[model samples]
Target: MARVAVVTGASSGIGAATAARLAKDGYHVVLAARRVDRLDALAERIGGRAARVDVTDPSSVREFAQGIESCDVLVNSAGGALGADPVATGEPSDWAAMFSVNVLGTLHVVQSLLPQLAAGGGGTVVNITSTAAFVNYEGGAGYSAAKHAQHALTETLRLELCGKPVRVIEIAPGMVRTDEFSLNRFRGDAERAAAVYADVDRPLSAEDVAECVALAVGLPQHVNVDQLVVRPLAQAAQHKVFRGPLFER
Candidate 1:
């Protein structure tokens, strides 16, 4: 029997790419996301399964987990930044939403599926965080704070599960230019989203991050990659990005 891999946020972006990659790697992929249409389409394309999952809703996640007989891997990718407002003027609702999904959502999913993971002898849990988890910047207070909390959760989970068969891992990507990430962050401002990658020319792609996830999870069961940080060559750090001709210099 093929090992089952459950991936959240699989409707698009890194989540979708990771599902595809894992499918190609011979695992039975269960694509989970809020959009049924996209999930159905991707499941058809990859010969996988789709489940409508809203990670923030515990009952919804519990129902989703109940359907799975076993899970060898759980990829928590159902997270995104809501707004880029400064702390002084940031909307409380936006911060709350971000925390609910990026932080609480991860916690809920991990708790719900942990038993399934353990049932299969050992499994891997991959948390898709951002460089913001470690680096603070202007206008990124809310999103960064939520990711930092997620990072902390990942670490604590690792420590708590030290003797268990499960492995906890985190993948932090920088400057990934996905279709909806920036647009959603800027609240549908096309021009602003476009400008976020205008000069970089070669920002990280969803597939790039997916490849990293695959690499870490594909390792031997006895080996665990605690954390993996990935970034485009143009991005040296959170506040540093090379643009235009200067990028190559």
Candidate 2:
């Protein structure tokens, strides 16, 4: 039987791209997301399965896990930023929501599916964190805090699974330009979202991050990539993104 790979947030963005890549790699991918309509379409295209999963809900995650007989890889990519308000001005609700999905949602899925992952004898857990997990900046306090918590969670899992056959990996990307990430963060402000990547050289695409995921997971089971940080050439750092075109086009 082919290896089984579960990708959450598979309705769009990095999760969707990773699902497609893994499917192309010959794994029987399970595309999990709350958006069943999108999931169905992607699943059919990739010859994978579609699963409705709300990572933030423990019961939902539990139900999803129960349907999986075996899992060789689990990618927790069901996370996003809510707003760009300063710490003092950020909405408490936004912070809570971020924490719920990015941290607790991952926790629920991992806890529920860990047994199946371990049973596979060489399972891999890939957590799609962000550079915000390590660095902080103004107007990003809420998202940064949640990602930091997720980073800590991934690290702790690695330590706890020290002797287990499973490998815990963290992939952090900076300045990825996806269709809905920025628009959702700005609450549907198209111009604001567009301005985020205005005139900058090629920002990292969802496929770029998904490629990193496939590479790490494809490595030998004994090889554990503790963390992989990916950023576009135009982005030197979180605060140091080059706005103008970097190459002659």
Clashes of each: 0, 0
Q: Model 2: per-residue lDDT, tens digit, 170-234?
A: 99999999999999999999999999999889999999999999999999999999999999999
For model 1, the run of ten residues with the poorest summed lDDT:
240-249
Q: Each model's TM-score?
A: 0.98, 0.99
Kindly report which residue stretches of model 1 are placed more than 4 angstroms away from their true locations once superposed: 245-249
Quote the positional error of residue 225 for candidate 2 in Å. 0.4
- Score residue 73 of candidate 1 by CA lDDT: 99
lDDT of each: 0.95, 0.97
Q: What is the C-alpha local distance difference test score of candidate 1?
A: 0.95
Cα RMSD of predicted structure 1: 1.5
lDDT by residue for model 1 (95-150), tens: 99999999999999999999999887799999999999999999999999999999
Candidate number of the best lDDT: 2
Which regions in candidate 2 have their CA more than 4 angstroms from the true location?
Answer: none
